[model samples]
Target: MKKIRWLPSQQDSHNRWVVFFSLLMGVLLDSISWSGDWGVAIPDVTPLILLYWVMAIATNNFLVTAFFFGLLHDVLYHTGMGTYALIYCFLLYPMLHLRLQIRNKTLVQMSLFIGVWMLAHQVLVWLITPANHLAMENIAFWFAIPISILLWSFIFLSLRVLRRNMNVR
Candidate 1:
C-alpha cells in the first residue's frame, strides 16, 4: 500500500481561502461608519489584518491581495481610484521584508510596532487625500492609533485561533 503525500500547493490553497475571508472581514469592519467625531477614531481594520497575515504566512506575497482589497475599499467609500491600493501596497512592503523577524516578537512589542506602522498608514492617507487634512488635525484621528493598538491583541489572538483551526500554513 502506498501512502499519499500532501502537496504544499494544497496547503497554500487552504491558506488562501482563510486569508481571503479574514481580509474580507477587515473590509467589512472598515466600511462601518460611526457618527460625528467618533468615526475618526475607528481603527483601520484591513491594514491590521494585512499586517497579521504578512507576519504569519512567510511564503505568500499579499501585496496584490492588499491592492485588490484597497480597490474594493475605494469603490465602497467612493474614494479616488488607487488611493487605498497605493497605501496598502506601500505599507505592506516593510512587513513583507521583516516578516520573519516580526513573527518572533511578543504581542506587546508587535502591537507597538503596529501602532507605528498604522501611524505611517494614516500619514500616507493624509498626504494622498487632500480632503482628509481637516480630519488629520482632529484629535480623534490620532486616537485611532491607540484604538488599533488596543485591538491588536484581539485581532492577533482571534486570527491565530482561526489560522490554527483552519490548518492554514
Candidate 2:
C-alpha cells in the first residue's frame, strides 16, 4: 500500500497564485473603459467582484478577502477608499456564512450573484458619490451584469475542472 501526505506549504503556495490571478483580473476588468455617450466612457462590468466572490467560495474567510479586494478596487477606481471596502464587507460576509445553503449552485447562481452584486455596488457608489449625479443616470449600465456573470462562470468552472484534472498522486 502507498500513502501520500498533503503539505500545508504547498496549499499556501497555491493560494498565493490564486490571489495574484484574482488581483490581475480585477485590474484588467477595471481598465476596460468604453465610450457610452458624448465621449463619456462608462465604467461597468466589474470582473473583480466576480472573481472575488468566486475566490471567497473556493477558499475560506470570504469577508477578509473581499475587504482586501474592495480596498484594491477603491484604489484602482479612485473612489472613496472605504466605499467598496464596506460594501464587500457587508455583502460577502453573510454570503460566506450562508454558502452551505446554496445547493447545486451553477452558472445561474453566478448570473444572479453578478446582478445582485452590481446593483448593490451601484447603490453604494450612489450613496458615497452624491456629487456624481450622473451615476444614477447610468444605472442601466448594470445591464452588463449578465455578461460578466457568464464570463465569470466560464472562468471559474474552467479553472475548477482544470485543477481537478491536474490533481496528481
User: Who wins the lDDT comparison?
Assistant: 1
What do the candidate models score in CA lDDT, each in turn? 0.89, 0.57
Candidate 2: where is the Cα deviation over 4 Å?
1-8, 38-59, 161-169
Candidate 1 residue-wise lDDT, 107-163, digit = tens: 999999999898998888878877788875697988888999999999999999999
Encode model 2's per-residue lDDT on 40-146: one tens digit a residue.
22334343343444444455555556667778778876878877778767666555655555424666775576556655655666677554458557645454455
Candidate 1 residue-wise lDDT at 82: 94
* Positional deviation of residue 57's Cα in model 1 after best superposition, in angstroms: 0.4
TM-score of the candidate numbered 1?
A: 0.92
Model 2: how far residue 30 lies from native, Å: 1.4
